[model samples]
Target: METPSSDASAPSPWADAERIVLGRDARGGAVAVALDRGGEHGRRPLSSTELPVWVSAREAEGAATGRGIRWVWSSTAAWYSALLGAGVRVSRAHDLRLCHAVLRDAVPSASALREATAWDGAPAEAGPSAGALFELDDLSGNGAAGSRRPGRDGVAETVAELLRQDAAVAQAAHPGRMRLLLAAESAGALAAAEMRAAGVPWDAEHHDRILRDALGDRRAGGAPARMTRLAAEVREALGDPALSIDSPPRLLRALQRAGIRVESTSKWELGEIEHPAIAPLLEYKRLARLLTANGWAWLDEWVRDGRFRPVYIPGGVVTGRWASSGGGALQLPRQLRGALRADPGWRIVAADVAQLEPRVLAAMARDERMAEAARGRDLYEGIVAAGAVRTRAEAKIAVLGAMYGATTGDSGRLVPRLRRVFPDAMALVDAAARTGEEGGVVTTWLGRTSPPPDDAWRAAQARASRSGASPADETRALRIGRDRGRFTRNYVVQGTAAEWALAWLADVRLRLTRLAPVDSGEGAPRSGPAFARRAHLAFFLHDEVIVHAPAEHADAAAEALREAAEAAGRLLFGAFPIDFPLDLRISDSAAKD
Candidate 1:
């Protein structure tokens, strides 16, 4: 923070800085203030050009490596994207927007920090580059990118909110745990932005080939060849050549006319009925979904210059799971994984933790029995070996039943046996379900609380308990309660699993940053200069990560994934005996050798 100035004896403000808050100054330009361990440093003008250079120098000097200057921003989604585009990678950040949402519900002490601020809303998308836009044209006041990004807080407001959040964390019941959750959530925001900038290494050609193989040729303004044939077959079987097979109501009526006697055209329901139309109808739905979701048009829109830049919305889900606004990053089908091809001299190190939620559940419940069952192997198989179930299939159903609050059929039958064996784990979810049934709240392992029952739900319960309530009213109330119970039963586990995933992602990001950058041409230039030559995380689903790296660094990246998983486990659930085993491999493409 110090320039070549009068006092030669003094040390630089950023030498041992705690954090840096980025916000708009009164002059409508960007300002950065360094927070020293002692107190706040004075505000200084930071332009789009100088900010990255100073940050790059700090990184080069290795000052921000450990417990370093965490960049405090109004919204990471609005800010970090441009930073990545500018080739400046920030090591750590405190995303006020994301943290505000987490605290407003989870930490009761932090409720005053709520008060419906702009930070509570969905984050603004990353706008045009500041260096290119604002630096060239002073259209908006702030010199930073996304100066016109709606709902952004200015310098004074940003610092005030940060202080409020810090105080909220300080007053929380478990301050350390609250702080860890905030850090993890913020790290997730940063990673999401960076991943968008980096994008998934994609091969447009392979994507096209896969599309053609499954959907046939890309017919202009019409259904693909395969889809057309299937639609015709479906129409012929229904004895209605003009039937709109895509229209569910019309298709249902047509099936009824053909004497199928089915309530719905769902594959599951239709598969139960033996009919000529069933086979072709099911095939049509499958291909149509694929074609609509990831067909030729998808390739044209998403894939660009060997990368598929999906817009990632971190913390988008109520359970804290990430949702994709664009390229379906969370739902990339296994069929198109072959399109995830690395560059010529680089490779893909893909690793997904096996049964992450169950493992997290065991740790949360501290269920030694379940932990022992999962020691160094598949939990379902371990259940069978432990004599709790006859087969892995039974174990899976029972475990899923426990988490999802299943109450009938095979799941209901098998759940009791699991409850008897792993009482602690089952009890944890069962209590959460009961809380949900009574309109109470349940919290994740790291303290993310489930949202309370809505007013409609509360009204239904109240009505059902009233003196004038009838059997139908009570039945409706009970059904809704059960639905909520099911939701909360899964929420605690899913949310905590998300927390674990965030920790994993943050750790992997840091580890990847520390690795040696390779000497190569601009292989994935869209990844930005900061990451173009180094091993970088290219894709992330909830429990899986794919790191694109140099061939020589593939082993190192794989090792980082393993180490990061273990580190994340300990970071969240210290001294827990649970382990996160990964089904990992290194390859040129997502295709099998």
Candidate 2:
């Protein structure tokens, strides 16, 4: 359904000129204005009832022809959620809030927009429901002055910010890279809103069954049967019948009294102590975590209409990785993957890049040796075969040490050996670490600048440098410096990996849009109208994505997932011979890790 001009690898030329701003009209009603060659056309007001219909018409029009319109909106969550609720989908958007955050830190020259009002605040999430209609009252005179959301402002303020953003990109040090980052970030916002609207195809029954098996039968106003049994076993082993297993401090004290001396009740620490209570206590803690994090209460709250919607905040992490404001979507346990079921007549295509961070680092450093070690399906195995290490396990340790700045155990000892083999890759991370240790900042491959040291950190360094500073102050300073160094060492790799994932997600979203919608009976109504039986990205983590598609188009969906991976690699590092192989699967359930 997309024309040749709709390639997602590069930024659009005409989209910059053909701006469609969605904001309030004069008297306080929502409107879509057209801007061309730097001038705005008259506003076309959209009523609450007519808003989704008009947007769907325009969006469908763009998808039909080769030419597409890039929607300039205040925030993706503020507007796109309502659009998706009505089953309308837009191709691309210029999320002013998301873009402003990027430019504020990355581009110092763009001070005008950075100093602008309401553009630097927290993103436009925490709004009303996606299913609720956005009326005139929400977009009227209560804009930046009252709500501090530029999207709520009248036509003039909104357009002014958009133009300022245009200027920001023009003055960027690497405008091309900045443009790609902004586009990828904005596309991520679109995908987040869409994913929340569509949600993961969830099976409430499967979730309950899993809960029953792991946690035992639910009890009214009490712990599960299996949990109670485990708690009893733990108490008996500790020789304290009145032991409060839920309280960590009390449990730790009980363990100490029973001769199992440990710092905490953590599984890792408890496992080292050869005490009978350790095993049952560990099992109890595991079950308790599950009950508290994703129990019956969670299922009742998150899962709705056969879907689990999660609120994603794009660029929430300083490293440009996505974070969840609610729903704990990124931390779902492996045991519950089976609960992420596809709807009837549909299949789930799941895929994740293998050794994503290492591959990204190889490309960024332009290290041919490292790239050769990462050319195959398993980067660790390839590293072993290249004689970097004797075994795959050792190779993994060295590579992880290089990226994460581990300098203490086997990682510390093996990293030097890796340094000799992959000098370029090691040098890149080493430079970042040194910069961070000196209170300097580092930028990712896509121009995402790392945050500098905080006031407390600088004060510690200052104390250490003073004439009368004691050994304590100097020791504290050295410790904190190493900590910051480790952070920056991984920040570059993780941030670029996030950018690559965003590109992959955006391309997959665009590709899925091109697939024809299936018949009416096969539609997943809970997923909204925009994503019917056709393939649609239902869930996304930092390095993985799960597409929900009709059974008939499963193969096509799988191909789209693979092609999007290749496109993302090229988009980030053109002609860089680095592979991002996926452990892909076509399954009825997400149980396969």
Candidate 3:
């Protein structure tokens, strides 16, 4: 309950603090609590109007004195967006909302904190207002009185949570890896916000042109000219002139009546059938997707002032990959890549890692043979050179099968060859699969533990073990168990790859900030105030990134992206001979040649 003395001349214990905790006070104002490696030392309060200036001064002072200040806040989306709006950027932050989710589920040593589910809530979306500093929604219905807890928004609760997290990390089975996971996860939150603020460069005219070229001219309230023609062709091919091609039920019934005898109306099923309507129906479906997903309506809604601003959710997926709530950032079709155009005086540096998951698997298992195979070339090609499979196509299928627990088809037939050639890597995934089948949890390379089986799964397993159990019960249990086994087999590799991507993004963001900003006259002002004059990240998928840089600084930005990737590799797997080469390009648009 003690507060910092208001006396102006009082010597402050937080003069050179290493970590600072920030939260809102009872009156909805900013509160700063300073801490060292020992513990909290002092606390101060600032008004809403003074918060920006205070942060700016602290950042300047920290930079001048060679002190790296890591800001601890409730949520990056809530706090950092406002700071960026006011032209203040922090190098590092500890997002309690994101970290709470990770620690509650993954860290066994943090059982005590897990019981307090007040911090378990979906991430706050970016909006005009900062809203509550700590909006503990208690979505799980476990908080006190089943009501909101405003006290958690204060500095005291923030400090308590931080202490609990630190203790959890220290007591974890692998403290070093747990710490790295938390840091990378937190950094990912920052990058997500920055990407949203600096939206991807889009050319509305070019987008419209692409749409027209594919779908023909746009109409006012109906399908485009080409889509209409395709729909007509599909109807005629089915011999039902008035049948609605858009409705699945109607289409399926029509196909059945037309002697197609298909069970479903899916494109894949339709493709397999030998019928006259197949090709036209497939083309109609493709054009319909483009029209509905990214048509003129989409252009009017999502893109604005030459930027597509999507809402990115960091740590959204259970495997630690990002998910977008709107704008379909992750699912940007290759057909639309050309619309990702840079500004007049800027260039886009697009880079994506090749075969990220398998390389991670090689480094994690320390399979020297697999690493040797992956030396300086495509992993699938390396597998072929090592005589594991006859062709690159077969090698790809076999490696994917091994990681995903595929047990049938050409993938299944080819997997044994890889198993013989790379026994260590095969053993790693095989063990993970076995653990999952036995209702056990597994952890990724950086300590992200998989969720425990639910009550239903446990009940099924128990039923299968009981005396006089029916064959149906045993079969069901075995099927579900294998399904979960496949999931856990892939989880470790995918989650670790996500961690690597986060590390790469964080390092690249830091390096880009160090590059000199373009002058006002030469800057791409349409990129918003925070990133208009500097090299900034524009988009990020799981293993790929696009940096929008001024034309003069394009080379520097490209080098930074490469260096960050190498740094991430070293940070994750020290001295491991695994390499992650990027297919990098610096061009005016994101389209590949």
lDDT by residue for model 3 over 248-303, one digit each (tens)? 99999999999998899898788898887888889989989988898888999999
lDDT of 2: 0.83
Better of 1 and 3 by lDDT: 3
lDDT of 2 by residue, 1-593 (tens): 11222222223232333668887654556666777775764356666667777666666566656567888977787787777767778889988888988887887787777777566766555332222122233333334323434334455566767888888888887889999999999999999998987889999999999999999998989999999999999999989999999988898899888887689877888888787887888888899989899999999999998999988889989999988978899999989999999888898899999999999999999999889988865889888877888998899899999999999899988899888888999999999999999899888898888887998789999999999999999999999998899999999999999999999999999988878888756577778876865689999999999999988788888899999999999999999999889888888989974
Better of 2 and 3 by TM-score: 3
Q: What is the Cα-based lDDT of residue 160 in candidate 3?
A: 71
Best by lDDT: 3
Best candidate per TM-score, number? 3
Query: Candidate 3 local accuracy as lDDT?
Result: 0.85
Cα RMSD to native, each candidate? 4.2, 5.2, 3.2
User: Each model's TM-score, in the order given?
Assistant: 0.93, 0.92, 0.95
Cα lDDT tens digits, model 1, 1-593, are 34433332234656556888777654446666677656566456666666666666655444534556688887787777766767888888998888988888877766557653555677667542232111123322334322233322567666766777887888776888889999999998888888888888899999999989998999999999999999999999889999998899999999999998989888889889888889989999999989888888888898888889899888889999999899887887889999999988889999999999999999999999999999999999999987889999999999999999999999999999998999999999999999999899888887888899998889999999999999999998999999999999999999999999999999999999888888766565656776788999888899998999988899999999999999999999999899999988999987644
Candidate 3, residue 403: the lDDT equals 95
